[model samples]
Target chain A: MDELMEVLRRALPKVNWETDQALVDDGIIDSMDVVSVISEITDEYDIEIPSEEMEPENFNSVQAIYEMIQRLTEE
Target chain B: MQSIVEAVAAHARALPEKFCIADSRRELSYRGYWECISGYAAHLRDLGVGVGDRVVVRNGQNLDTVTAGLAIQLLGAVFVPVEKNAADTRILEIIEAVEACCYIAAKPMELSCPWEKLGDVLSFRDESADFETFPYPGGADTAEILFTTGTTGKSKGIELTHRNVVAVAENVIDGVEMKKDNVEVIPVPLSHSHGLRRYYGNMLNGSSVIILDGVIFYKKLFERMETFHATAMDLVPTALSALFRLSGDRLGDYRDQLEYVQLGSAPIPQQDREHLCRLLPNTRLYNFYGTTESGCSCILDFNAMKDKKNCIGRPTCNAHFIFTDEEGQKIEATEERPGFLACAGDMNMKGYYQSPQLNAETIRNGYIQTKDLSYMGEDGLIYMLGRQDDVIVTGGSKVAPDEIEDAAMQFPGIADCGCIPVDHPLLGKEPKLFVSMERGAAFDPAAIFQFLKDRLEAYKVPKQIEQMDEIPRTYNGKLQRKKLLELEAARAAERSES
Candidate 1:
């Protein structure tokens, strides 16, 4: 979970991954940021996030992203 | 000359039953579009939106926003469309700049200007009502005020007269050969001059435009295009990057169906241009170079000008260029000597609103000096060396970031790259490269620099390299080099503290 937080931090350094609950909702993170996160996680975790899985819900918060990653890895 | 507003009304009368615009929810025929425009105009007029009044509009690229724009124009009021999600400070700045008479948004927001929620504005509209009439505005009247922060750091409102708007649209029509049947899919914001002008060009030709906001649902967007039988698109380079990343070879699949694709807001790299040319050989791919100041000036057809580099093509039929030195003396850069690019035409802007000093410096004899280091080749096509402010002065020689980034884009496993200037202790300003790796591609500084060394001149080679999660770009997909420089500045400060 900390590792996922690190990846999120690296993707958008200006963003506060810890406390910012509505990352996507608040417009702190945009479509481009999501793309970067996808790329970074794919490179780090070696898991391919399919197009269908690239939803706003999966990336709105750190915990959501962590959960999504776990689901993909488990699969 | 028929103004853009008049053209819309004409299209309504001439092609009443033909398709006009479609958002996510519904589609409107030319007649239906006109009816809606008229309906909204009458309502706004009642709400005290008078002729020549400036109206701050929220542009979400929905049917209401687009319809209301025409309504504002119809009333002889100036339409000031801005991004929906723009910061409150920025919106306040614009309102104060124009002394805006009213602000129209998607929802009710407490504003300095007279506030009217778009839904409430449209509630009084009766679809069954007769056509509302107003005096069509003259060609010289200010129709739209587009705000841009380019050229100077501060925001400046660029006034586009009805004549200039018509000429800008016509230039695209002639350059891209837009037909009546072509349905252009516009995901870009309408507040932007590029997207708005593309809309005008389509409307002028009696075509259709579909508003798709972003690449969040781009796979569905591709499917929507297929559903609409979309034959045209006005896209930026970053959107192309996102789409390519999300779905490989999807756009290429629409080569036959799409008649033309107009690319603008930023210069495309040579390899990507050539790759697109090969992919969409039949599709007329136009890489246009223009600004809010000089509307849609240069357009290069990749299918025609294959294997070209740094070429922004020739000035459109309406525009004529004069390259000059720092002192603004006209010098035709027919080959090697790149000069400052200036353009003069009906398509050019009137002048920056209330900015006399900038107007004097930029606009001369109807020619607006574009701050780009450009040269007209012996082939008569204009080629950009770089933006004048962005040219890196390393040692004695000058290097354009476009050259570095374009070369790096061809480097193996590189998805995106930005070449930015960093403060060098000796050289004064030095080139540094920041890259984002492609899928499954890891950052390898040694291999990358080695590849760049062979391709670039020794001086042009970046002194330092770093991996960016993604290269930062404007919403329109132009490389935000200034942002990258700021990032470098912050890094330097951190280094000093540590």
Candidate 2:
């Protein structure tokens, strides 16, 4: 999860991650970015992010994306 | 009251034998054109179309379409012309939104409005022309309801009054220095301000208008231009670029005959303008800067292109422009800093029909906030940056898409490009470029990246590049960036699953 946050911080430095919701609503982190993020997450953590778990709501927030990666790895 | 009607009657009386509109099929003189419009006007009145009634006209660009427009105006009713080739859903949406009483379609088609065959309307050869003149609603009455894609969200009706239309026509004539003998080949969509203004402008000047079937077929367009001996023509950037590339040699044949080539609607790329000037050295090129809201704002002449390059030229007569900040305060022309472009003019539209929210956001006091960012140089020419909404901010740095796209297009093999923002974990956002290449050309993404890197700043370089078969465009040939973004998102999702 820390690794995921680190990668996210590198990719989106300007985003506060704690306060901003512009990623999903304003079409900043669209579905393509979701796939790329999931792929990068799996490679870094050595775990797979299932297709069903790729909903926009789950990956909308930084914390949510990290949690999803943890759940997928544990499963 | 009758003076407005007299304007049309005066044109008919003055130039009865003069060619009014010519299409592929036939040519109609001013006298014949008025007679047809009079018949259609009588037909519309019999069908209960009175003042303020919205009439939807759907037909290809032909003499009949021009007649339909004149007929609507002659009867003092609002003309809402839907693009003939518009998607059925889009057409229905417009009809439903406008609440049109009668729709004049070229053929029997399913539409929300009661579709009437154009043949049936025109076939009523009532030679007993009583010419029942209705009380002409001067400047205030809605002349046309032009539907422009709403920047606010949904498509809204732009209510243009008779005064607005006439003001625009006069502005085009004065700004372009249109002569009475200048024959203009109008190939733009009649639904748009470009087409309507050109048609009426030619009529106002007693000049001939050669209406092509549509603007899509470049070969046919050249043929028609030569056939009619067209001296002037108006084109959007895409059509102009396509014609420039397709008719490179053929254009030379008519180079001497052609007088002026007017471009508007979208930004004319610097390279494309240079190529056009090179091809037709004798012809003058003009770029018009205006919107459906304000009819004619600036006219960038051929000479201005050499020095100002992308500048939209000075404001036209009867129009004034000012750059405003976010807070609506005026910004002075200085060495640095560009501001939002605003217009104060007679050619401005009345307001969005039944849209108080949009009216409030767009028009404040007497000025229309164009939402287009621009700066005035020392030469007093206004250079438009891009739309305010099109600006992308990544890693605290704001980026304009036009600068990136313009730089990218300068590279070989690239035809058209659109830059959209993609979410980045560290950067907050990064530009994802979508490019369309010229036919029979192979694109190397690395070469493009290297080219962009050489031309632009490191931060402005596109993080990702996607090649598309063709760029999606609106009916008027303006790039649909939002649609491209959607396609990019969908493609990304599909790739993830694979």
DockQ of 1: 0.22
CAPRI level of candidate 1 = incorrect
Cα lDDT tens digits for candidate 2, B142-180? 888898755336777888888887778878888888998
Best by TM-score: 1
TM-score of chain B of each: 0.93, 0.90
Score candidate 1 by TM-score against the native: 0.86
- Chain B TM-score in candidate 1, rounded to 2 decimals? 0.93
Alpha-carbon shift of residue A58 in model 2 (angstroms)? 56
Candidate topping DockQ: 1
Candidate 2: C-alpha RMSD after superposition: 16.0
Which portions of model 1 show Cα errors greater than 4 Å? A1-49, A53-75, B120-132, B149-152, B269-275, B422-429, B438-440, B487-498
Question: Which segments of candidate 2 are over 4 A away from where they belong?
Answer: A1-75, B1-6, B110-113, B120-122, B125-135, B149-152, B215-220, B302-304, B333-335, B393-398, B423-430, B457-459, B487-498
The ten-residue window of minimal lDDT in model 2 chain B covers B1-10
